[model samples]
Target: MAADLVSRVKTDPNFIELEAKRGAFGWTIAISMVVIYFAFIFMVAFFKDALSVQVYGVITLAFPLGILVLFSAFVLVGIYVVRANGEFDDLTKKIVEKAR
Candidate 1:
């Protein structure tokens, strides 16, 4: 049964399209997050003095930038959830129905 399903899946254009779209979107999101995270790490490692410098009276640039990084994680997760629940879920349901 599983083999038959796999055969059907392999031949289906919709399956191919879905895989392509999902792979592309997943990789894009993954790469973006990695770049954002590594950028913060790199900044911390190489530009320690800049991050240490006071932005206002007492608050430093590092504090705000660190907060921005944390905020960005939540924002990125929201983005993925929206896409997965909406577009990706719709496509997945369509494919499953066709398989059935």
Candidate 2:
């Protein structure tokens, strides 16, 4: 039964489309997050003095940038969840129905 379902899934066009969409979306998000994360790292590494300088009276650039990195992670996760729950889930259901 499992093998048959697997064979069906492999042959299904919806499954192919689902894989392509998921892979593309996942890679795009992953690359974007990596760039954002590495940029923050590079700034901290190369411009520590600049980041350490007081920005808003007492707050430093590092503090805000750190918070931004954290916030961006949450935002990215939310984006993935929204796409998975909406478009991805719909595609998944269609694939499953086609397999059955």
Candidate 3:
């Protein structure tokens, strides 16, 4: 019975839509994060002199860029959570209901 229900859900249109949407959205977020992180890493590796420049008293330019990279992860997760709770959850509910 469980297998049958799972098969039915897999064949459902909502399931397909959910899979495609989730996959694409996940990839987009992952790629964005990778680019942002790598850009910071590259800057640190290749542009130490620039990062070492004084931004304010006792603060270097690298300080804010590092903070931004950390905060960007949190912000991206928050965005994913919002979308998952809204669109993804709705599609999931529909798929389960249809399976039943």
Candidate 4:
């Protein structure tokens, strides 16, 4: 069965198109994520001093005590997960279906 599906995927133009579409979507997501992560790093470097703070006692000891840095990390992770599980996963599933 698996071999049959592989043979179809190799011979079918539609399956090939779906596979290429999936790859393009995956690459787009990856490149956007890399750009966004680097932009965050650049922002952090440019505004390091702004993030420096001495909070009341316990919070002061914690790293990235600033709200900006914490929220930035949270938003970045949220974006990554949403994109990965939503767009990329859907594309991959479609490609698999086409292959079969």
Candidate 5:
């Protein structure tokens, strides 16, 4: 019974759409994070003087930039969560109902 339902869901057009959307969205977020992280790393490796400059007393430019990298991860997660909770959930519900 479970296998039959799985097969049915796999054949559904909505299931295909859901998988494609999630895959594309997931890759986009992953690539965005990689780009951000590598950009920071490259800056550290090849542009030390720029990141080392003092932004304020006892604080360097690197401090805020590092914080920005962390903040961006959270922002990206929030973006995924919003879409998942909305469109993804709707499509998932449809898939499950159709499968049943």
Candidate 6:
């Protein structure tokens, strides 16, 4: 069945194009996220003192805020994973079926 599907994909131009487009979009999102996250870290490191603020009317909050932002990136990645696995996986399955 797998071999049959592979043969069909090879013969189906639409399936091939959809697969390529999906791959490109996924990679683009991944790379953009990595670059933006690193840039945020670099910015925070360079401007820590400038951005620091007292919280609860006492403790400094700069470090905590930075950590929160970093943690939120992981949350964003989780969302990306859910969307990609749910939507993109379905799209790929459809393409494969059509190819087959």
TM-score for every candidate vs. truth?
A: 0.87, 0.84, 0.85, 0.44, 0.84, 0.58
Cα RMSD of all models vs. native, in order, equals 1.5, 1.9, 1.8, 6.0, 2.0, 3.8
TM-score between model 1 and native: 0.87
- The number of clashing residue pairs in each candidate reads 0, 0, 0, 0, 0, 0
* lDDT of each candidate versus the true structure: 0.88, 0.92, 0.94, 0.63, 0.96, 0.71
**Clash pairs for candidate 5:** none
Summarize candidate 6's per-residue lDDT along 1-100 as a digit string, tens digits. Answer: 5887678777677666656766787787678778767776776779777556677576667666667667877876887788778776776787767763
Clash pairs (backbone) in predicted model 3:
none
Index of the highest-TM-score prediction: 1
Q: Candidate 1 at 2: error in angstroms?
A: 3.6
Q: What is the model-wide C-alpha lDDT for candidate 3?
A: 0.94
Worst 10 residues of 4 by lDDT: 58-67
Alpha-carbon shift of residue 75 in model 1 (angstroms): 1.2
Q: Rank the candidates by lDDT, best first.
A: 5, 3, 2, 1, 6, 4
Candidate 3: where is the Cα deviation over 4 Å? 1-7
* Model 2 / residue 79 / CA error / Å: 0.5
lDDT by residue for model 1 over 1-100, one digit each (tens)? Answer: 6999989977788778878887898888888889999999999999999999998999999999999989888888888889888888888888888899
lDDT of 4: 0.63
Off by over 4 Å in 1: none
The best candidate by lDDT is: 5
- What lDDT tens digits, residue by residue, belong to model 4 across residues 1-100? 6888778767666556655765676676567667766765775678665445456664532254335555666776676678668766776677678764
Q: What is the lDDT of residue 59 in candidate 6?
A: 64
